[model samples]
Target: MDSSEYILNAHNKEEFPPAHTAEHLLNQLMFRMFGAERSRNAHIERKKSKMTFTLDHKPDRKEEKAIETEMNRLIEEDLPVTSEMVDRDHIPDGVSLEKLPEGASEMIQLVRIGDYDVCPCIGRHVRSTAQIGRFELLGTNWDEHAKSFRVRFKVIP
Candidate 1:
């Protein structure tokens, strides 16, 4: 979750706040479920978004549906989202630094979705998970050669 996405939110661009926040939560959910890291590639947008993760094998339909169910359950929990600034060196373990873009500040702002997720990000997010709406996994694709699976999702208000 250590990435420039959060900081990029401050720029007041066109990215949707709720969707962006949900992306963070979804990313963390992937990590929790599969012990996999965040998406190696992502394209988060208002209407729909996609995230690609490296997995030993692709998940079955049951697993994919489970992901959607769990994600929506978390959103309905209405957990609070908070942010705090911490020194770069003080970043907690399990947070990856690979996505931090160039020219990032020494102080990183971490966006926390309750106790579920705490990652350095600069994107705009909803104050609570309830604002994230229902998470729907629209589709999935697998690449055997790369051992990668991509999940496309959207939020239903």
Candidate 2:
């Protein structure tokens, strides 16, 4: 479809593209490793970001380190990041509409990171994975009762 045919949601925040892109990778990684859904809450910024996921059990230290390692590996792969405008009625398999805003348009913009991840998004992102600096997991907190795992992280150039 032509550019005019695409409808992007109104993004209120000017996010750091690298960090924003990393959030996508992290979300995909979390889903793959834990059978968890993508993070429903995220705070992406230039210096740091945080994402919270609901899981059946908290990931231990070894698993957390593996997350960092895997994220960096993906970034080093220099995967291409691209976006496509798809009709809302024909959303691709495995692409979830759960995160779409209530008033999202009929034409949705889907961001894909190589073959690793794809989701409906309107935020800015780097054109390639290598453009995202090193992925670092700074800390994590688990609320057992709530089954929530929150991770704080940042990227280094």
Candidate 3:
């Protein structure tokens, strides 16, 4: 379909498209590696971003390095980022509505990063992964009590 057929919701925040797009990649990577759900909390900024995921165990240094490696690999793949508007009732398989904000509209925008990842989102994003620059994992913190793993990172352009 044409771009005119797709409607995007009014975004509350003006995110740095590159960083925001990187967040999607990170979320998908976390899921694929640890079977963890997408981050429940996230702060995406131009210079730095953080995402918190619930996991059964903390990822060691090697695993952390692998996350960075895989993210860069995907970025280097230069996948196209596209989106479509879909009815809530007809949401595609593997797409979850659990992360949708409260009072969201019935028409949802599904953002797809090539064949690597797809999710319902209304945030700004780069047209392709090549625009994301380099993925850097600055640090991480694991809260044993909460089972929360918070990752701090940024992209170097």
Best by lDDT: 3
Better of 1 and 3 by TM-score: 3
lDDT of each: 0.85, 0.91, 0.92
Per-residue lDDT for 78-100 in model 3, tens only?
A: 99999888888889899999977
Q: Where does model 1 exceed 4 Å of error?
A: 1-13
**Between which residue pairs do clashes occur in model 2?**
none
Q: Where does the lowest 10-residue lDDT sum fall in candidate 2? A: 1-10
After superposition on all CA atoms, what RMSD does each candidate show versus the true structure? Answer: 3.8, 1.2, 1.5
**What local lDDT score does residue 120 receive in model 2, on the 0 to 100 scale?**
87
Better of 1 and 2 by lDDT: 2
TM-scores of all predicted structures: 0.89, 0.95, 0.94
The number of the candidate with the highest TM-score is 2
Q: Give residue 23's lDDT in candidate 3 (0 to 100).
A: 96
**What are the clashing pairs of model 3?**
none
* Candidate 1 lDDT over residue span 35-134, tens digit each: 7788878898988999999888889999999999999999999999988877779999977767887777777888899999988877788999999888
